[model samples]
Target: MITSAGPEEGKSTTAANLAVVFAQQEKRVLLVDADLRKPTVHYTFNLANNLGLTTVLTKQRTLKESLRHTGIEDLSVLTSGPIPPNPAELIGSKAMKQFLQEAKEQFDIVIFDTPPTLAVTDAQILANLCEGILLVMYSAKSGIDEVNKAKELLLKANGKLLGAVLNHKKAQKEDYYYYGG
Candidate 1:
């Protein structure tokens, strides 16, 4: 999953929340902090940034060395290790591609928290990598023009654009419920 917006848009929070939902369903999920340019998944989860995905990508460390066990049982995380100078080059490299391939085989779902598409090429570079990209939008914050630009980037990448996830849904009408039981 590629969680991003222009900027200051709570992309990481959305991604982390999704991980929580998946874990609640008993799925073995691994969160990959692919946003090397500005990584915050680790911080969101309150995990260490000592070592992670960058280590695996740069081949300075192995996958076993980088994959850290979060407090959540079914969920693990690979943080963006030691922010590198060439984050775009690294993520768009052959090694990152190879790592993702192997990761799919190991975990049920691998969620990638990447940079905002409009802010940098990092998300666009990563959009090409994942099976699906989820465009996150903030209520009353994101404009149609910015979204359209992102859509264009998505088109150029040949990404499997899953759909948009509308966050911060404010209730305009009174909350209603139907009994299923």
Candidate 2:
């Protein structure tokens, strides 16, 4: 799952780009719009939003029926359907877990774009279900206290704390960005 402490931190963009990169490597990738409250995957991919994760989770549609090809080799997307009144409950339901497991079995990588951790409990709920989380934070916009709080919330939810991606970091003349273990 990809999320941030607050909105406009590029979580959705990161998830979409990651999925694309994984697909470019010849891996089957599924980019899921799990941010039920405010989904953008449909817009990002120019796909129909009538049926998707929420539809599958609510048993209104089959998973296969909800998935839409992104015109990218080895890549597919499952946009969040109509926004529900109780997004957290829908996301944390047992049905959601089953959907994720099925998706994992069908794809080499399943990346989810979730809401901001501090904005709602939706991200925390998803974090526990996902293998790990990539917290995106704009270097110039995010504060240490917010990051710390987000980490603490993840810890409380037993979410795997994957290393964060510091986005929009101002690069210096001699500086370079490197990401690896």
Candidate 3:
């Protein structure tokens, strides 16, 4: 799961790019839009928002039925379907765990784009369910205190912190990209 201290930290963008990279390597990748409150994976992939994680969790659709394929081979996406009134409850429910288990078994890599750590408990909840959590922070925009706070929250939730991603870094040389660990 990819999350940050707050919004617009490039969590979704990082998740999407990582999913594509994994898929390009011939690995079966599943980009799950777990950001039920404010989803963007469907928009990023230009896919439908009809059926997805919410649908599966609510028992309205099976995991298989909710998955949509990207034009890139071996890449599938499970967009957040129908914004529900209770996002945190739905994400922390037993059904969400079961859904994640199933997804883990089905894909080589399951990349979840969740909400900010400081914004809600959704990311913390998902961090516990997922194997690891990647913290994304903008270069100049992210405050040190907020980043630390987000890290502390994840630790409290027993979420594995897999290194931080420094995003929106300035360009210096040809190899200098926007984001790096």
* Best model per TM-score: 2
Which digits, one per residue and each the tens of the lDDT, describe model 1 over residues 1-181?
A: 6655687676788788888789779998988888887889888888888799989999999888889888888888999999999988998899988899888888898898888888888888888888898998887888889988997898698878898977776855444433332
Off by over 4 Å in 3: 173-181
TM-score of 1: 0.93
Residues 86-154, candidate 3: write the lDDT tens digits.
999999999998998898899999999999999999999988888999999999999999999999999
- Candidate 3, residue 14: Cα displacement in angstroms equals 0.3
Q: Clashing residue pairs, candidate 3?
A: none
Order the candidate numbers by lDDT, best to worst.
Answer: 3, 2, 1
What lDDT would candidate 2 get against the real structure?
0.93
lDDT of all predictions, in order shown? 0.84, 0.93, 0.94
- How do the residues 1-181 of candidate 2 rate in per-residue lDDT, one tens digit apiece? 9999999999999999999999999999999999998999999999999999989999999999999998899999999988989999999999998998899899999999999999999999998999999999999899889989998998799999888999988877556444321
Residue 160 lDDT in model 3?
97
State each model's C-alpha RMSD to the native: 1.9, 2.8, 3.1
Number of the predicted model whose lDDT against the real structure is largest: 3
Report residue 78 deviation for candidate 1 (angstroms).
0.5
